[model samples]
Target chain A: MATKILIVDDSKLARMSVSKLLTSLRPDWTRFEAASADEAIILTGREHPDVILLDFNMPGTSGLELAAQLRQSHPHIPVAVISANIQVEIVERAQEAGATFLAKPLTSPALAAFLDEAQARLSVTRPSVR
Target chain B: MNEFLEQFLIESRELIAQATDDLLALEHAPKDAARLDSAFRAFHTLKGAAGIMDFDAMGLVTHATEDVLSTLRAGDRAVTPKLVNNCLACLDQITAWLVAMEESEALPEEADADAAGLIARLIPSPRPEQPAPVPAANPGEPTLPAHAAAILQEQIEVLALPQDEGTPGRTAAAMRVMQNIFTRFGLSAPAAPTEPATEDTARPQRMDMARIETLVNLAGELIVVKNAYGHAVSLAPSPALTKLQAQLDRLTADMLRGVLAARVLPLRHVFQRFPRLVREMAASLDKPVRLVTEGDATEADKRIVETLFEPLLHVLRNAVDHGIEPPGQRAAAGKPSPAIIRLSAARQSDEVVIEIADDGRGIDPAAIRATAAKRNLATPEALAAMPEPELLELIFAPGFSTAGAVTNISGRGVGMDAVRAAITQLGGRVTLHSTLGTGTTIRFHLPFTIMLTRVLTVEAGGQAFGIPFEAVVETQQFNRKDIAAFGAAEAIIWRGKTVPLISLAATLNLPDTPPAGIIHTVIVEHGGEWGAIRVDRFGDQLELMLKPLDGLLSGMQGIAGTALLGDGRVLIVLELNEVLK
Candidate 1:
């Protein structure tokens, strides 16, 4: 199976910029976007994306809350919480929820490291797909 | 130049306008919570978009403004006109920065100073009870985190406020406190602005008017070629050829309609900008006026809507400048104190009628007559003989103005003439109507669409011409004996009415046909003027794409545009109104 990614951010520009960067880096990867956490959850269920990049501050069901829900439902899938506001509380909370915290605006090197880590984590946990 | 960045710029521009409008609305209904939330959201969205593109200056300004809006929403701060003005100024600055960014892929050099200035102005005038002193960072070290750095810089600028010169700053200390709290929680520093991989970035594309025009033109060419092919194959028609032709015809017609539909846009795109304009004009002129627009959702061809902005703006300026009375004068005249300017657009059959009406002292024919005579536009007797409507029409005459003094806005006498010329250039006509004390209405009748026109082709003077079907009332075959010479012109009796008949060949300076035989005449009407132009013969009516004449032939009075005929000949579409004039 090809690598599938989902980005959930209320800002359209953030979604587009991140998608462009990801596609350029991993040419074979498929990308999807959702503008809200509710939509993000629904798309994740339907697409079963391998990984998710979620924004921290949203109108409702913020990234931290959604991260906990996804961790409970799909432990094998990695969720990277992308945020502009990164406090220790959020970072520890996200970590406790079995998700990683990534700072934005996303740069090339940081994104590569995150993806490499995600790939290793995914490959180790899932036996059905390499 | 990347698609994401380009989209960010475009979306930011729109959000700035939306924020400004909502801020202004909130100024009126200060307690409207929903409107307040909407205004705050616009700023928040703008800040997020700017952050994505790493537009630090824009992001900082919007962030500060968002904070103020949030305070208002939380009922911690009052919504004052000063606050609204501050918000509007921030929107204006963002708009300018966006424009600069569009031109050069970065913000302007003075962006920092402008943001600092606006941030300084955004600080509440009244001081909070107790201020927290900011912890000084070590010299030559960057102590603040990235996100806090932007806010810290703004707060440092706030330290220079004249009234708060000796006061300790809460903003910087607040940022420090937040950063320390985050550090205590064991979180890493905030992310720096991302530098994506160096690749060629294509701009995000939208369906703008120029691209639509190209599509429309291509569709038109397809039609012309299809028509030519049909004509060629008709001589030796077969079942296969007929079937192919029918399919091609349906495909091309569908393509043309689809392209034309894509070019339709609601008038609100143009109408929305005017509320801001009217508000500014009201403030500058100190004249209380209300602008009411109707039928804003009416749609028109994209090209027409784009070209209408200037002409509509000119007429509207004229209404505010010359038509509307001052508040004092209006009250004395027993009219409403704040004058009303109503701009309404409606689709009337195949034409769009736009009316700019104002409730004020109407145009005086005697004043126009005096101006016309003084400007040498007409002789004294001629001016007297000119009826009230015709006298008012003099306002459109070049270099004619009845104003005794020239002001900043409209009195240089150059407005209405240009308005009429522009409308006429688009193959439309404009007229004026005014009662002594009621008001003045300037009406423009424009073609519903400029791309394709239905016209009747006529052959005169050994050349073919296309007459718009809308102008052609009827066609008659008259014997030469029925035509009578009247002074320098000729006339014919048709349906108990005497219509002026002029030989098309003579008028066009073409080879004269023999007058001894039957004459073909096509009657045309343009703005209450009816006449018949004699032609040699008539051809089939066609829906043709009108391509305006170019270069030196562009302004030749009677030629509207050129169209390609199926036989590879060019047909001149006549400006029948101009010809009649």
Candidate 2:
């Protein structure tokens, strides 16, 4: 099955930029965009994306809160909390919320590395939730 | 700008606008947890955007603003007028940074300094505790054993303190504990005092506002000089001079167009400050006034936008101080506890009209008439005969005070009259419309561009005068066949409607007698009244630069400014608004 991904951010540019990069790298993958955490949840319920790329800070629901909720509701899907703020506290919160962390202003090399690792994990028959 | 930077600028500006609205909403409803949360999110998103764009200075400021909003959400701080104002100031600084970013694609040199000052104010007061001193890692000291490192990592995992991925050492342990201590002491460790990556030089260069203004002003002067040169070319009649004049004219026009494009700024530059102003004004006066701003995207000349600040302040102050009743009175009247003052702007043809309307008790015509009569400023019969609007007009009369006593809030020395004068000086007009028990709307009609104007030059009182074509309905000859006498005013029947007529020579105190036969007349409108102003003769329509009259000529009632004609004569630019009024 083709890998499905969901990208959530309040900034349209940020989401488009990441989506464009991901499509250029992996042509077969399907991508979904959501402007808020609420929309992300709705999209997840409808589409069942295998991996989620969420911005740490959003207007209504923060990434940590959404991640925690998603961990409870969608245990099979993996999540990555991306942020430009690499503050130590935020990183810890993301970990506690059961999401992997990714730094932003996502250069091609960094994104490629993260995607390769994610694909490897996906190929091994969906890793169990921590 | 590259596509990436362009996108960044666009997104950052929109976020700033949303953040401003969120800040004002929080101020309006302090208990509305949703507003506070949204505000925090806005700043947080902006910080992230700034970070991706390499605008560290802006990110720093937004980070601080976010922290303050976080504190408010946590109930560590109350939402006060001062706090809202501080947030507004932070946004203003961010706006300045955006301006710089547009010009240089990087924050200005003072970005760090400005962010530091605002962050100092934004960060909540530090907890009162003496921090344990951090021990510097000495190279000579032995590193922690593998067993000891493992034990330390276990403790960190249990405590949930962030773990550095590198293998643990005694030095790393010390550093982690120090960071933990700072976090526990409720302080952000004055991070990024060392400057972040500097401005990327590869980005497209942006011009600053001052430089743009300088270019615009220089271009305006060149147009004036070109007119004078065209006069010289006509007088001297040389082929070379004529050719040079044409080239110079084209160059000046192009330069002016280019510079003026840069000088056009949105009305939000001025409108953004009103939320904070009204909020503070309400708090100080013990009256609840909610400010609603609209049409912030309406664009106007930069100079006009700057000059709008004072007059807007005066009108808003009046709305808050004298217009809106106290909360108790409003509640008794079955009105909303907090009155709404709407400040809106829109482009109307060649003019931008800004209206400040309040939902409060409107001006009392009786009080105005009584005040006029008691002050002996006007006779009782005149005051009684005047219409309600005319009665309200008395408020703009110098020394007219309808307020029972002067208060520090608005009515001290300057009244609505001063507001009228200030706006008038900018070649704009102010008028008041009120309905008793309803509200008042003070409207200002200002020219869209102050640099250049399309005017019809007319010979009035044997002197050249320029009248803005926007205000002119049409021109016709004043014939004896259609003339009639109306009390002390001259009237003419045009299209079967009686129109009042005023001789420009007489109104301007020029030495010219009214002609008996046909005379040149231009019909103009001001404040809903249309009238024909008779002049000696009509001249050519010219696009001219209007240099405001200074010194002795500055205070002239009807003259807006002066421009140079191609014939080498100075043309007095008539403020048609004032002349018609």
Candidate 3:
């Protein structure tokens, strides 16, 4: 019952090194960080979770207006972004808004192929918020 | 998460000792509205507890230390000491990545993207880190020791035992207080102590303050080799080189100020988080406070008791948000609906006072002379001829609030200009007083160590400055026809007071010219005004070393940092809070 995950950054050491690399890939994910995009829209208004990572530049707000305010108030919170300023129209604007990209100094096999294709596109859509 | 990363490394070491006593109380009282509201609530509670402990490299280095403490909390930049030692080395690299994740169970989070590329070089977008030959080191050990060799070059490994089964009563009460500090330092306590992650590198190697500043530079090079063996025993030399340089400079400056008084600490780590911030600001304002504290063992200088803990937690959260009271207005002002405060600490002369006080509803000086007569900042006949300690020092100005509203845990005034720029960058001074319904101290003082001062020695445009001794106030030798000419500017008039002059070639834009006549001045002062300056001479008083003004002439103005003197040269000092702006 873990997979919570959010991890946006403004870096407290890259959010404690991707929260100690997802707590060392332990009891499977829980992390969280949002220092801006008004705290990932107040942490997806306190719930919308199951994968986010994000970070594309911070300061006032901008993770692409927090991925268009999490695609209009949490479009089933997908996001992945992550960055080290890798451009290509920022992965073609996070693949034209439908999120999921990685390019950063981030390792662990590019965060395990972004949690294996965002857990097969969240088990075909929302799958109980993973 | 390891008790929220040990309460966010004891609240980012009390917001890096409230940004090093608000950059040493804004270097002796700069535009202090209570040290820029305690460096904007210690970088807004260390960027809101490093964004609720995900620690994104200490929440993007405290969100660029809350945009340089909200640009010195809206007075738009001034609190310097190199931006309080680069937000105290980004709270010593988030306390060396929380003591490398409490001694490695692993979490140097691979030095969190090289500590967010050294906190995006303190904020100036277009990212990258190449500039490591200087500035806050650690890019690849450019002279490391900061975070003491990044927490003694991390290799720690001990996170395996405590599954919390009475964690062996917290590792046998931290091994009986490290065997009572190793048998009170004489060492002998290892009788039967062998198991619990014992030899994985004892890195918290205590004896701190940079090992008591290398035993105060080997007790000042053994009192300069006992004053060069009392000048070679007044030339009568050989009493075996004057009793071996007076017994090796009296047992090395009494064993280096007795092991630098074991890195003096006490003031209970500066009153350990003010009784949990006065029981969470008197149970979130239903009021009924208490607090107390007093000297809490009163020692000093472990970097000034870790920077008088967040400017005495924003003077006990402005004595529980605007001096206590609440519970039915302290029983309709007859008092006792619950309030107390106090807080204390001692040591004076070469400083460390502290205070805090409170009781309830005190400060009012007509709500700081009607918020400095509604921000025109005094004029209703100068707020009716000011004085009541200048109307309780206009409740430390800035955006002075009496707090009828706006507050999450402190009125909107912003913790008295960060407790007067963290006790004026620690050469210190805060003062307040109050009194109305009666009760409110404030105080502060500081200098147990921003590390030495005194200064004076002059010279001006042909360089060499230093100044300091509380910005001087007297220097003399004028008459190049009493220095007048006010077009390209340069006034003087001295005694009956006329002041505003500049000269070391119009304050260092330099081209030379002073030696052609007999003109000297110096003056300095600040709160009331006095500049005089015009130098070209006066050099006697010595003691230098302050440093901090480099990132290549920090965009020069009237210089305020650079010191190396003990007969070497490089002196430059002046920044009396950017020459009182």
Candidate 4:
């Protein structure tokens, strides 16, 4: 089964670019996009994606807030919060919300490392039947 | 261009336009929260876009602007004109980079330098209550000292060794050892796995200008051949040939129209830059002035649009420097305190008319005459005999300036003559009109395109060359007796004025035959001075497309470009300014 990933950002261009990067890094993984935190939350409930990528800056319900909310309900999924403005306080908040902090202009290696870790955890907890 | 970059350019340009509009609106009503929020969102999105492209320098600039805007949004800092101007400057830099990326499909080489300068300017003053924002640090990588790394390696190696059943606690013991090492080195262990450094393998494909130029040249050559074919058919006067020729003419005309349309761009690309510039200039000069632009949507060839900035900048500087009087002087004169400088462009039948008008002190013809006489640019009798309009034209004379003291703004050796020369090189004409106290207007009449050039071919030393027809004032045959020697130089009298003369053959260091009786000369004007060039004979005038020299002959002085003639010969065109220099 292919792993499903959700990409969320306020800007459509940003979402598209991130989706492209993710596809190049993991060709077999499935990707979904949302333009806001609300849409992302709705999609998460519907798709049950294994991993989530969120943009920190948005008009309503910022990425960190949504990350905290999702952490409460879905404790098993892995989350990464991305932003161009990476202040120390923001990093601390992301950690407090049980999410990983990634810098913007996300390189392939960075996304690949996160996905690799998620894949290992998934394999150990929910092994596929042969 | 790749699809990704094409999309980038299109989206970034829209963002820039939106940001510029919001900023301009905010300048008028600084307290408008809606505009402020809109502007902030624009910058934030632009920053995100820059980040997605891995344009680090562009990211740095937009990030700085975003921080400043956020501070304003938080009500911590009040909106100021300086802040607005700085933001606009940042957008201008981004726009410049976008243009470069569109042309080359790669990051600009000067991005770092531009970013550093702009970031310095964008740095906001520190508030006593809030500390300055710290520079971002990479959180993923936790570097270790060489000795500490060695110690960790030793522990890992020890753990890897084979052990008996009694040494089952070896893994736990090695973990304790690593904790001790971390404590001693004053470093915290990484919270997550570290990623190895990876090279970026994605390189955007670039569009080649040389290929495009070759295609354009081929198209021009085809047109020339088609014209020749028509001529041949005309000579024979065949009905079938005439029908074929008419069909060919229609197809060629359509192709030419398509090509020319692709090269046309709106004037806004150049006009949008003046608002920020005028603001800075007004602030520096301590004058209350406003800039009003009209007909920015008018279109012109891309070459004309790109080459217009410098000359227009000089003209605007002059208008702000000498044309506009001080606020106190304006108040005393009962005119509006904030003087207006209007920049307008309109398309004429086959030309574009651009005018920069200033509603301030106009040119005083008497002052110009007095200055001309004092500078010895002309005799007192000549200055007295000249009309007012002719006297006003004296400002364009080289080394002729009426400013009492030189200011850094306008009069540092570059005069109106340079502006005229630049315009003339583009097959354009510039004229100045002024009323005593009402206003002054500088108008430029420019061609719609730059591909075709009308050249007057001349032969010197048995080799033919081309001179731009616009630069040639007139041609005359002077008797050898009339040519007088002046200190190893030759001079000729033309229209009751003594003009210096130089032999083109001698200047070019070519073998020449000495003249016997009369010298065939062409009088050319450069930088407002008339000089005669002696040649063997003048050839037929022709309109041809000029191709700039490339590869080996690139940057060659005194030669502008090469044009192909009808008989398969190459005509070398001269850059008159450099040649005369």
Indicate which candidate wins on TM-score. Answer: 1
Predicted candidate 3 versus true structure: per-residue lDDT over B1-581, tens digit per residue: 46556545555655565555554456446687667666655665565555554456666666677676666667777765455545645654554555556655334554554455446546646743343422433454234223322322332222235455534433433343333333322344443222222111112223255767787666655544454556557568776877776687567656655665666777765464455445545665667676766777777667667666666776787788777877787787688755788788888866778788887778777776766777676687978887788777766665665444666666545547666765666567687777788788888776665544557877766667777877787888777777677787767788887887766555456666765567786788854457877778887664443655678876575565666554445677766655644
Instruction: Estimate the Cα RMSD of every predicted model relative to the unseen true structure.
Output: 11.7, 14.5, 23.7, 16.0
Error of 1 at B164 (Å): 45
Interface RMSD of 2: 2.0
Ranking by TM-score: 1, 2, 4, 3
Which TM-score values does chain B get in all models? 0.79, 0.67, 0.31, 0.63
- Candidate 2 positional error at B94, Å: 10
Ranking by DockQ: 1, 2, 4, 3
**lDDT for each residue of candidate 1 in B1-581, tens digit (9 for 90 to 100):** 76766778767766665676677678767998878877887787787787777778878888899889978988999888678867766776665555556656765554665676577668745863323434437664434434444554664564455654223222222233333333322345342111110000111224386688789989999989987988787878999999999899889878887888888777765665565566556655788877778887787777677677778877877788778888888888899866888888899987788888999789988888877888899899999998887788778877785455676555555657888888876768999999878999998898777767778999988899998887899998899899878997889998898899977777777898756788888998876778888888988788788887898768787888888988899889988766675
lDDT of 4 by residue, B1-581 (tens): 76667667666776776687678668867888989878887887788888777788888998899889888888898878778867876776676677557556888664675575567667844742333323325664445555446657876885787876523334433444464455333557432110000000001112243455456667688777875786587678888999998898778767765676556667776776676567557766899888888999898876777778778888888898889998998999899967999999999988999999999899888888888888898999999999887788888888686455576566556788888877866767789999978889999888887777778999998888998887899888999998989999889999999988878888778887769899999999954557888999998776667776788767776777788776667888887766675
Highest DockQ against the true fold, candidate: 1
- Model 3 regions lying over 4 Å from their true place: A1-130, B1-100, B104-276, B279-311, B314-329, B334-425, B438-454, B458-470, B476-543, B547-581
Of the pair 1 and 3, which is ahead by TM-score?
A: 1
Q: Model 4, DockQ value?
A: 0.30
Classified by CAPRI criteria, candidate 4 counts as acceptable
| C-alpha-based local distance difference test score of model 3 | 0.62
Candidate 2 CAPRI classification by DockQ: acceptable
Q: Please give the CA lDDT of all the candidate structures.
A: 0.75, 0.75, 0.62, 0.76
lDDT of 2 by residue, B387-430 (tens): 87778888988778645566656755677888887777666789
